[model samples]
Target: MNLLPAYVLLDLETTGATPARDRITEIALIRYENGEEVARWQTLVNPHMPIPPFIQTLTGIGDDMVQAAPDFESVAPRLYQYLDGAVLVAHNVRFDHGFLKHEFQRIGIILRQKVLCSVKLSRLLYPQHRSHGLDAVIQRHQIVVAARHRAMGDVEAVAAFIEAAGRELGEDRVALEVARLMTAPSLPPGLDPSLLDELPETAGVYLFFGADDAPLYIGKGVNLRSRVLAHFSGKTTDMAQAVRRVEWLETVGEFSALLLESHLIKTRQPLHNSLQRRQRQLCAWRLAAAPDIHPQAQLVREDAIDPTALGDLFGLYRSRKHAEEALRGIARNHALNPRLLGLESGDVRASSEPDAQHYLRLKLALAAQRLKDWPYPGKIAVREYDATSQRTQLHVFEHWCYLASVDNEADLHDVLAQRSTPVFDLDIYKLLQQVLLPPAKTGAKPAIGGLEIVHFQDGYDQQKTSSSSQ
Candidate 1:
């Protein structure tokens, strides 16, 4: 590609795919500027750890090869010089770049650079081409490779492909593609592109901020970078226009992301997020009237929704109107007295007929069997593991109540010691029902997965200790 801007065609052989845990075994790059290759560099790095046998077989670089080679710390300065101002290029560049970043960061070095993926470039440039790996590119361009899995060999193949593209498609076309690949499209006015580069391609929560860094919307995804960019990469809407800045927090896995997203959305009540607001005022309909009295349905707020005290609750609704409307629909279908359910304004005395009693029985029978109660005896902690981070968090729940979450035992004790009122959230109930309950038996809700459910009775140890002391 004819360019004043330099590009470092890079490749790395690593111990494993993960950047955080794996070590780089080899490094190589071909530096180019103004359509000419100025220099090429390759080095075997001593990982200070044993390389797996499978890795050795794949790259043909054994322990003996790297025994005398310099480690990454020794080669950092020179490698940084080659990468400092250039657009980093590699097949699946994120993998190589993520590995190098972790390596550099360990020694107190921050490596941030614009990255272009040759694999993506190939896919974009040659839409008809299926595979864009080094071997595929080598075969496609009729370029012979001296080494197959070696770092320099892969770099050479990538360089040759660029050269071929420039020759066949013209220098201007090649440069245009390079420039396009390097930059993100139609980012919000003042929001920097470098911010996008800062995001990791891992599970995380992302927040969009408007004028004063006020959270506009918060969302979670398995891949943060792609999902975040997908927002601005499309046609600029009100969300795109309003987003002046962005922030993100990376999690170990999807489960952690899910928990954090739910928690934040419930607490923060971000302006743009309408679905899962604080739900502090969540309410449900509970049949409260006796047979002699008119059949009455009352709204039970979260704080007062103690299932032990208040039995036989009906539809969970977000607002009073919604609850009334639901009751109205149920009454109409059963031809129960609308005045009794507080749906239509009328005299309750107008419904003393035996038909009214029959309709009330019909309504209760229709809504009776499915008023679900807490299946668990007491407080339960569902342990969730983040495999990438190897972190475990205990999600403490009681009677379908999310009391608190703790990452360690001490914090878990503290969470258990503190007594918070069981706020019966409609969303939480539905979510837990869908996940924790059985679908075949309930037939009313979906069963998501089999979770590790543990039951802990509150203050049991204290009560036993007091009895023994007496």
Candidate 2:
């Protein structure tokens, strides 16, 4: 007889795949120690979200069945306690683990444990077998699974498979294979052991810190945990060694993650985030007062931009020097006068008269890149919704400048009542490319993370006039 290490056979029934957009309907786990069953637990989790019709039919966990069940918050504490210091075993552990982590992430809890996927275990132990899913395992071993898709039934099936494997091919061989599958990630000694469990696989911004809590690096990823883990997998640089701790903030999608990362890097000026030096003063050149004889380019500071009300704007640059360099390059390429572009303050004399003709064409070519003024006459809102988390955020914008993000219509009123000038961000301008631009400009259909455009045009003229006069 071989003594098996403490482990929990686990299974979950979720509303759907893609953990970011789905909810766990149920959880079942059977704990075993020294090759004997020690404890067993199961629960119907109130996802606080709707269970799709297909999921209900497939899993037989209808909305009505889970209506009065305790939400994950109510059960998280006990569930966390139950899995402590035990390896998590499941048919396809990633699927189960993903749902568990995502659910815990919503309520700001970290669920981390060594995971052993029995599906993988089956393949490893029985190399001759091509099919390793629970159904295949059950069919091959002739084990009874009373309930097919239900969590407890599936968990029991997994436990049975392990037992059969131990008897058929020596417990020692099974235990060694289980140990290999249960390997945990090796993390930095300075970081907490539990931190890896909390780092969500969802889109988010991650920050790394060094000694004295200095911002070492700021990064964004769709799968935050994998990206953060890859950085520490090998001792490649000082970055791996200098890091003390890691922190992350979750976003609904990649668009939000990238925007948040850029904003933090610019604002925090992390020592390791080495791209932009003059990111703090984002600026651009705008073709002011369309078609005047003196078609001069005006410097539009981000602090004063109303993107929705803007005219032809060009090349969002972080510094005055880069903006000037770009304008000069454009002038040189198009044979336009640099003086008219505000790169120089010299007069347009008789000899330089020919360059003015070139300036007119330059304005037209540059118009294509111009920021679209708020097409609607007034303020409008762009919405971003997370299908899985069921979280919605409405970003209010005026003249292309983002004003505020509100959760509900009632909150929209509060955001509008406060008179605030919309500031432009180069980072946001680029981030908006993911959603705001149509196929022609971005060269693809923009997926705005469920962005719904809403117009708030009533009494718009008055506000525009008031802000402009000021």
For candidate 2, the clash count comes to 7
Model 2: lDDT of residue 138: 94
TM-score per candidate, in order?
0.72, 0.68
Tens-digit per-residue lDDT, 7-65, candidate 2:
88888998887788888889898888877788999999988789999888889999999
Instruction: Look at candidate 1 and give me any clashing residue pairs.
Output: none
Candidate 1 yields a Cα-based lDDT of 0.74
Runs with alpha carbons beyond 4 Å of true place in candidate 2: 1-6, 12-27, 30-85, 91-112, 117-149, 156-185, 274-281, 287-306, 339-347, 350-356, 416-418, 437-445, 448-451, 456-470
Runs of candidate 1 exceeding 4 Å displacement: 1-5, 15-22, 34-37, 48-67, 106-109, 122-150, 153-179, 188-193, 210-213, 233-245, 307-311, 344-349, 352-399, 403-423, 430-470
Model 2 superposed RMSD (Cα): 8.0
Give the Cα error of residue 183 in candidate 2, in Å: 4.3
Residues 301-381, candidate 1, lDDT per residue (tens digit)?
767778554346766667777776766667677777777666678777777666446556645644653457776556666
What's the distance in Å from true for residue 305, model 1?
2.1
